[model samples]
Target chain A: MENVLNWITANQQIIYIVVLMIFVGIEVIGRVPSVLHTPLMSGANAIHGVVIIGAIIVMGKAETDNYLALVLGFLAVILGTLNVVGGFVVTDRMLEMFKKKK
Target chain B: MELNLLTLCYLIASITFILGLKMLSNPATARKGNLVAAAGMTIAIAGTIFLYEQDGEKLHNYAWIFGGLAIGGIIGTLAARKVKMTAMPEMVSLFNGMGGACAALISLVEFNHLSKQLAANEVEISAVQPTVLIIVLGLLIGSVSFAGSMVAWGKLNGRVKDFSFTGQNILNLLILLVAIVAGVILVLNPGQPLLLYAILGLALIYGVMFVMPIGGADMPVVISLLNSFTGVAAACGGFLYDNKVMLTGGILVGAAGTLLTILMCKAMNRSLQNVLIGSFGGHKTAAVAGGKQQGAYKEISLSDAAMVMSYANKVMVVPGYGLAVAQAQHVCHELEKILEEKGVEVKYAIHPVAGRMPGHMNVLLAEADVSYDKLMEMEHANDEFKTCDVVLILGANDVVNPAAKNDPASPIYGMPILEVELAKTVIVNKRSMKPGYAGIENDLFFQPKTSMLFGDAKKVLQDLCAEVKTV
Candidate 1:
């Protein structure tokens, strides 16, 4: 972990510049077509689904001194759990809400 | 000149997300777009994990986190399995609420983190400029979405009335005024205790103001709109963290949410003003009395209507909330299969705002694993109804109402409708011919050739299918 932080510190400038370019590239491509948006967006939303997993990772990083981090990590876990459970249920329920009437 | 590989991976994932979005713009390429976006999401998660360093503190133990994940996964799968076809709207609303709530909660935590740093003089006050501002806005809007979406879910589940609160217009304006006052105070004194409480209070009020007035019929549209708001809020949060994936994901949501909001407006035949400002979300209070012009009732036996639909060469089945209440998708599916065996071309007409949500009809059919090709959207099948040998309408109303286009006096005037009135032999399956959720009688029901099949949708569709096969 220390090694990775040292590496990030050393390359912060370059990482910043490259990430900026990536943002610009994304904006340009997003404009060229519209239908592709849903797939891409869903992909993004699904990725955000990882916030729960990320919360777990954050929890793993927490120490006794980092009380705020621990609390936030736990909050993230709860919210993320809700996201995954509530999201799929809502999707299914939303789908089922349309059955034909007799 | 060194560059972190994890950051590079995040960039790559961002690119994939963009490409996936570009491809999704067209229906033919939608599947590919979805796959590419999924890939981007996977790459983003993988990259973030690699970049996340546990430098200052020991990582929390996996016990609770992993257990929670497992529990969530199991519950999610079970919930998905147990969901009825009619429960999708409420489910979607619930999910939207979670998404919005996540952003709100994240921003709140970030707020506390930033404030503590300022108190300790750990970071210069000026350092909090754009990031802090963006995060605050995210928190405010996310809270609104969360609260509003919950109301939408409640309405979808019939837990709340379709009507708005009394003095809804005035209530909305007062909430906006309070929220604006809160915002001003926050900007002037970011550290003030009163300002923080005001922001929380106003945000909660804003959500109720936004959602309270919307009618039940518009719950799906409201859910879609909130879904967009959540995206924008997340994007704002991304800006706070300077995260590439958050930015890209936020933009995707912004675009998707905008499109959905527009489509929803079209479905309701409403301008954004009607939904957002004019209390158009509420049901119409004043319905004209027909002044004793109520048409004579002509009820028919279910078996008799079934007999008529039995020998039809081509059939168009229109399913609505009636079918949902009866839990009749399986019977409808069976009826279709039976009709097909008897040489009838059975096709289903799906209204955009059918049942309780957008694509409600399609979802119902899809649940039955009805062929992907069997269901046709309104525009494609409206004309087909003309040539259709029999149009079996299963427990639907409002969407198929002809009066919307023809009768100016009708509450639904100028609204788009399914052209089921064009069908020659129309068979309506209804438990009773009550006014729809919108509180309007269907003109198509009173048409010359139209006959009501009184029974449960599942029973009627199944019995009709059964009898049709014998002929």
Candidate 2:
């Protein structure tokens, strides 16, 4: 555990960039025109569902006897999974209808 | 095979997420954009499970992992397939809340593990300040998002009414201060599990209280704000674990969610602070409803409206939440086609906040197979309305209300609205003279040139289509 912390401290600069990169990324994408903003918002809602990975990682490392950690970790995975799957699927359903004029 | 490869995979996934978001700017590529991001998430998750190792131990809890995934995936699939278009906002809120709860739980679980280490003297608490900071952030923000989103879902679902009393804002502030103080204490004393639990409880309560007073009308902005909260919380989890993909995904979601919330606030002419603290949806404004029409409103028959629509060189159809309530979008599309068949050009004028959420009307219209090109945003649509021969407003009220444009005393004053009044002839199709969702009378309904066609939007448009065919 201490080793991971040391590694993180060493790579702090990279982590900050990764975090800041999202803002730069959106600025480059520009304002999502109002017509597609709902889908965009919902789609972005699903993208954050990737936090389930954190849940999985934490659960894997938890001591087998630590039931509290295990339960919280398991529930986190469940909820996160729901967010990712439901969010993307619904966003897709809405976006597919946006067809150009025939 | 190495840690470097794992980081590389995460970087690739993050890039895909950004690419997907960029593609979402246009309607034509939004679906494929979602798919691309989904693919990136899949890779990020898969790579972490397979390649990530710590202290020579690899993750082996397959049963718990697969069980959670399978159940969650099934529920998500069913919900996505069955939810109505009008209920999309609530669904998004529900899912966003789930994601937030997940982040909070992760922070809780990690904090517990860390506390155990501290108690065992396996590690010094002082050495983990950075991790502690991230954990508290995730715990605080995630709790707020989770609880706040649940309230938003209730309001959107009509299960929860806006609750307000005197000094509510002060109470909310007090609770927030208590949570922040608890968070600070937890940072200083990292081994205290009870303090962590207290912060969690207080933050959750604050979340509920913060949103309970906000009216249903402010939900789009609240939902957007909560969505951003979940993103930042998720990013904290990423920072805690040093997972590049999680960090990148969290940042993207965070930035985009903030942008969305600001856009919603701008559309409504409300500041974010007002949406958060003003209780704009409370009972203060409830008494203003149930008043009689102040001026005379003229009602038009189906034939007259159809005649006006059919002979017009250019017609603009303005739809609102009432259109969705009547399930009239498809029928309205039929009216547009019939008018087009009569050599009248048809266009849809969409307000920024039209329907239940931003871009909601476009989704409804798209479901009816309305061509994307026919959907004009508020700015362009307002410009076109001046040259339009007729404006056919389908159950629309506040968006086309003259109050938004000319009345300084109106509650919706200073808000940008569609300029349907500028058209040569204005025809509003409504069930009756009742006010719109905003609970305000539309002055446009009483204009000399404005004639109201009273009926359910679906039935009225159907009758209008029939009349147009014969006219």
Candidate 3:
């Protein structure tokens, strides 16, 4: 219990950010109409591609001899990139179809 | 100095994500919103690649990093460019699964690093309890999301069939319990690498079982739920690495997905629990065993259907998944144009869950170059149906079924339908009387005012267009 409290105290800033962001997320996302659900989903999917940063950090820091970490990190980078690039491109395609009628 | 620059970049990325999501609420700014977010993502990635430092040392392994990025980027771009509009739901599932896989791999890699640190006696297990918990959670959630999404992708593409045995839901629950217990044990005892893999295995199994029995009609809700799972899993990664941008993005997606899931459930008038456990459309037993006998339905000729639509003062069209299957949106658009040319008002009625995904019908119609103003959502279209002279249902069944409103015993009883029976005449186009994606018989078919015009959606729309032109 003391450990947990210490951790919480040390990471108070992170906890605040997380809580505030959750509310912001709910408030902002609540207004999206059903028409844009799929595109918005795809867009958010792209956003989580920011996990690529984590993958990059891990891969860069792993020792050359740590094959397991290197391999797993490489795959993470690949999948994260796929999520980011594919998500944005697919969302763009879907949105393009919604082009205003001339 | 470098750390400050990196923080600035992350701040920019976070702001753009918020602005992008905010703008996505309206159609006018939606495309630009997506572009703005993408630009922010680029800035963040570049900053991380150039400025990120660990323990006073810069990152290496550029060859591996850039190579993986190149391969993934090329494959993602090509796949996204080539996918058919009708196959979009599965494509989304596939890509979301990839994200889940990445999060899981991140957990695995981090766990391996932690074990190595323990071997070197550098960090105490007591000090790393929180990190271990996050790693376990990321693994559990990410694995489930990945496996469940793969199954969803298969189901959407018709590569997998719904399979369930009696007590399967209980079995799923048991499996989930075990996985959670394993995760807890692994967190408490960080030395057991095998337990971690066991949790991963159990999570994957639970994910498959979780989605295996869900009826196809409920896919939108399931996809939304799983999307949120992936988001939460990604957020765990953010928590592990203290990446603010990742945390914000993941939270946003998690919230968006949860809200969308709730909206889909409400649209269908089903509770989330009911959607998860009850197999509404997976089997024919519930619909067939309890369903009241349907009377004979009358068929309408192409010419007569065309005449009714062309001469009607107002015609309202309802489209469904079968239309996309037949690749007939363009032809349907042509029929609408023809009807309008005859001085008839033509509009489309889009049920919220009309197609495979939410707003799927709108995407289809938009792709066909149908004017946005002419497509009416359910409430507006329901109001207009009363004044409509003809309601032409193309490749659609469940949304217009009166049983949803009238029959309490029906699985989809409380779902709000289009009230197409209110129109003067109703023409339904379908391949046959085979039940809709939900496997439930629509009572609206046997109504006196309703006429079935059986054919492929594309062929029927093409013939209807030709006939309407003559009329």
**Which model scores highest in lDDT?**
3
Per-model TM values vs. the true structure: 0.82, 0.92, 0.96
- Off-target runs (Cα >4 Å) in candidate 3 are B282-291
lDDT of 1 by residue, A1-102 (tens): 996687589657545644554454345344322212222222333333433434445456555476676666666656555654555334324323233344
Instruction: State the C-alpha lDDT per candidate.
Output: 0.64, 0.85, 0.87
Top candidate when judged by DockQ against the true structure = 3
| Cα RMSD (angstroms) for every candidate in the order listed | 6.4, 3.3, 1.8
Give the Cα-based TM-score of candidate 2 against the true structure. 0.92
lDDT measured at residue B430 in model 2 versus the true structure, 0 to 100: 82
Model 1, which residues run further than 4 Å from truth? A1-69, A81-102, B1-3, B22-32, B53-74, B277-286, B289-292, B466-471
Give me the displacement of residue B359 in model 3, in angstroms: 0.7
Residue B437's lDDT in candidate 1? 65
Choose 2 or 3, whichever is better by DockQ: 3
Give Cα distance to truth, residue B248, candidate 3, Å: 1.8
**lDDT per residue (tens digit) for residues B93-176 in model 1:** 665666676676666666666677778878776556445666567777778878898888788778877555567778777887
DockQ of each: 0.18, 0.64, 0.76
Worst 10 residues of 3 chain B by lDDT: B282-291
* lDDT per residue as tens, model 2, B367-466: 8889988999889998898899999888778888778777675667788999988899999888888777667777788889999888898988888889
DockQ of 2: 0.64
TM-score pick, better of 1 and 2 = 2
lDDT per residue for candidate 3 within A36-69, as digits (tens), equals 8888877877877777888888888778888998
- Residue A30 in candidate 1, Cα distance off native in Å: 11
For candidate 3, the TM-score is 0.96
